[model samples]
Target: MIKPIIRLLLIAALLAPGSAFADTEYARVQFCWAMGKFDHTIYFGEVENREDRQASFDDLLEISGIDHHAVKCNTSDSTSHRLARAKLLKDWRDSEFEIVNTTFLSDLDY
Candidate 1:
């Protein structure tokens, strides 16, 4: 009984610090867009919490072949919203892909 308890405590001690550190080191990225006819916007983003798992924005651009400098929109609406968008943009900018223009085509049922 005593040996099992000691082993459990040791394991917990070794893993506790790593779990806490991981929680702090992870970062989140999101992609959001609005489509006509839908009540809410569509969003897709990645959360990169690990150093090795984080994808460079430049790589994303190269793969997609997009220019990042052409994006021109006021993404700053609120503090929380701004921060979330910034994180996504940072990843995109790092990959060298810029948003040019976003147009939404309406699909209303007549």
Candidate 2:
């Protein structure tokens, strides 16, 4: 089990947007890919299935002005996922962006 202080420090570290990856186009793709692939019921509510989840992610990419087809999620880079996940977590915690909430993803016509 993680100690309280350690957990708090971890949270604090994630909350800090110190990495440039948070704003990169590659990170955007990684973020969208993760949103599509993961179970985000706590935030965006439930998706109908895997297809719907992917469709939602596609819609998100479209809405964000990104080309879904052109994106090549660099799965080899662990740092990229960490940075993207951190950015997502930070946005969720602070409610800093529209993309991080249920309303934004749910409202998309998937």
Candidate 3:
């Protein structure tokens, strides 16, 4: 019983940090998607609500404490292309967190 408890504690210790790191990575990917959207909006001369987008990005950066320079946005692609890529990234990011959460919860027998 003591050995089983030790093993469980070790497993929890190992998985705890990984979950936090995965959350940070998810936030980083979200920031990257916002960056892509910002670039795409500006690339097409859509300045009507540009300030709003900028504010949203700024808010996210401030809240997440993530460096804006960490992720570079691709400006070579057309706005539509960028939007499509952003959609794919969003889907991947969402699915990844879902899997991580499910696995983590299952591993803990929760």
Candidate 4:
């Protein structure tokens, strides 16, 4: 019984941080494309908000410096893209307009 209790305590301690991390909110985003009959998808992970998302994309463009005419936004809004889009709009600010992805990073990092 003592051994079992100790193991449980250790497991709880190990999982505590991850559980707290999950409780923290974030924006999850993804990108998809099609080629004839084939399709491809890429996951961009979670981002903070619209400005942060734009900034991240801009940073990506700056580093990789690719010429992409448009940036698609998603959250938990549109039926097709629900949860992520909604989170973006819920945290919407006038200064920022769109979100690129969501992050599991802590609020401070965001």
Which lDDT values do the candidates have, in the order given? 0.30, 0.39, 0.28, 0.32
TM-score, cand. 3: 0.23
RMSD score of candidate 2 (Å) = 12.9
Candidate 2 residues lying further than 4 Å off, grouped into runs, are 1-29, 33-56, 59-76, 96-110
Model 3, residue 77: distance off in Å is: 3.3
Q: Please write out the lDDT profile of model 3 over residues 1-110, one tens digit for every residue.
A: 33532542343343233222322222211112222222221111111111123344344444544333222222122333334445534443543222111111111211
Identify the runs in model 1 with alpha carbons over 4 angstroms from their true place: 1-31, 34-77, 103-110
| lDDT (tens digit, per residue) of candidate 1 on 1-110 | 33532542353343233322223323322222311122222212232221321133223433444433221112212333345455544543454233332222111112
RMSD of 3: 18.6
lDDT of 2 by residue, 1-110 (tens): 65533543464455344324443334222223323223222123223212234456555655755432322222212355565456545544553222334434643564
Tens-place lDDT per residue, model 4, 1-110, is 33532542353344233312232254433321111112122113333333335445434543543444334333321232344334333433221223333233212222
Q: Looking at model 1, which ten-residue stretch has the lowest summed lDDT?
A: 101-110
Lowest summed-lDDT stretch of 10 residues in model 3? 41-50
- Please estimate how well model 1 matches the true structure, expressed as its whole-model Cα lDDT: 0.30
Off by over 4 Å in 4: 1-51, 77-110
Evaluated against the true structure, the overall lDDT of model 3 is: 0.28
